[model samples]
Target: MRGVVVAAALLLAAAGAAQAGPDLGNWRVDAASDGQVTASLYATNKLITGNGALGYSPVLTLACRPDGEPRWSEWLQLNDAVSASRKITMSVMVDGTSKFDESWSVGPRGKLLVREGDDGIKRLVSANRLLLSWRFGLLSGRGEADFDLAGLSEAVGQIAASCNTDPP
Candidate 1:
């Protein structure tokens, strides 16, 4: 626990970045299910806590340094109903405003999808902690690559709000 805290601090320092309006504080996940799955998740500043029934033990912890850069990453192991983890790399940009994120996941599953332009909405589904389901252009496939949209959205919002409040 201590090591993770230190590492998170160091990562923020080395990057010298800030997230969205939240100021890059530790956020927690609040989720519930049939005493075995996550149904809701909430993140806070002081503690990145999470409550759920799934095996999603890891909650993304973050720390923002106004003088340095800030970065964070966490893998969510989906069990039963969904099995996936996203390793996202992002930056708060020295100026803070917009954030750029790219993630990759691999698993099993397939479906049909309709192709769309530039920013396409891909639907990823999982029934267990080992297989994954995703929809592409009029087709469905399975692999070990996935993205955490919630995390990305939070990160981007934080930076955007920060910039609105005070630009770099």
Candidate 2:
């Protein structure tokens, strides 16, 4: 019984040390086709799930090159020659499950430059612990339901600071 208790204590201590931020909150955002967009992120246990919605106005511009290569810009510029609008839709799940689908090039649209017709890539960074709800591209163009990242981060910081153990 004493050994079991010691093992349990060790596990609990490990868990406490693994927490990313603070609150086990959620982040959901919505963006209209008008060009404006909203992004949100939050902490849940040691995991953080968030949302990033694109809007209609203010347009979500993509001007970055692939692999930070100069040729990437030229390739993307010429990508227009292959397809029309760089319009795309990207979705990310709470468990770091996300996908990106687009026509022409992902660089101009998805921003991650995923293969065409392909859904997206989802990788478990840390034993389902340290998740990365990140996908550079287009999400929703109207609205959505989830937690906000920017706000959640701020909130987590406050909460995590109060905790004796530091949040990741």
Candidate 3:
């Protein structure tokens, strides 16, 4: 019994240390549809999962070039039960300054790339911050979210390193 307890304590300590190493709380590398590698910020824990039905945790996807320069970014709300074809507008702000504003059409599946193209994703990541807002239902419904761009630079570096791409 004593030996078992000691071994269990050691294992628990090891697990805690491992979780501390990378420290990417909700960010994960997603399989790429195109050549670029992708990392997404999503909640997988039970607390977030429990509230999944309420559409609380939207997925924020960031794609990077092979050389670690940001390629594009996307956001999509998940688990929304309403099946209405709708139009929405998304805006991005950094340091209280609006950087991107675009309209998107969401299908019945509730999946939409809220913003894309040569938007300011690279610049935002370079500056290490993001602020997002969206409006739907003919501007009747709106929401906003903020994020602190901590450790993203290192995360992007890891993506490049994993793919064996030279960092840009």
Candidate 4:
């Protein structure tokens, strides 16, 4: 019984130590096959009231390219299927300030690619929270999601350094 108790205490200590090391809550960074570094974060709050709902939280991704026409790109992956090759109005608030409320093009896979040279990227990098709301036509209804930008700056800095691009 004494040996078993000691082993359990050691295991608990190990688990605590593992949780303490450089934890990026709700954020992921991955490297693509073509030398692109991408950092993504899942929304803390999800909207799932529409038809065929999957209850999936939206994803916000920022990609930095080593060699490409556009050095960087930002994308918002929605939960429902969106009409591709069309523009949709998306409203974004960063740190309680309305940054942008304009039309953005919807790309393949229901991902909305933010327009190039938008100041929203700069605002997002320095924001602590972000709220996004959009409507995918009448059939799809409306959807909104909020993200906790806890470690976003660090993730973006890592991607920027890896791709040799400026941090937004």
| lDDT winner | 4
Cα lDDT tens digits, model 1, 1-168, are 999999999999777754323331233332223221111222221211123332322222222222323221123232222223322222211123344443433223311111211121111111111111232222322213222334433443453343332211
Runs of candidate 2 with Cα error greater than 4 angstroms are: 20-66, 69-147, 150-168
Stretches of candidate 1 exceeding 4 Å from the true structure = 1-56, 69-147, 163-168
- The CA root-mean-square deviation of candidate 4, after full C-alpha superposition on the true structure, stands at 3.6
- Per-residue CA lDDT of candidate 3, range 1-168, in tens? 999999999999999988776655456775555567766764322112323353365556666554334345455554442233666666777766756776755645654544454354556556545666665345335555566656566666666566566434
Q: What's the TM-score of every candidate structure?
A: 0.20, 0.24, 0.58, 0.78
Q: How would you encode candidate 4's per-residue C-alpha lDDT over 130-153 as one tens digit per residue?
A: 888887667666678789998877
For model 2, residues 59-99, the per-residue Cα lDDT tens digits are 11111121222211101111111122454343434434454
Measured by TM-score, the strongest candidate is: 4
With a 3 Å backbone cut-off (N, CA, C), the pairs that clash in candidate 3 are none
| Location of the lowest summed lDDT over 10 successive residues in candidate 3 | 43-52
lDDT of 1 at 133: 25
Better of 1 and 4 by TM-score: 4
Q: Which stretches of candidate 4 lie over 4 Å from their true place?
A: 1-23, 49-53, 109-114
RMSD of each candidate relative to the true structure: 17.4, 16.7, 5.9, 3.6
Clashes of each: 38, 23, 0, 0
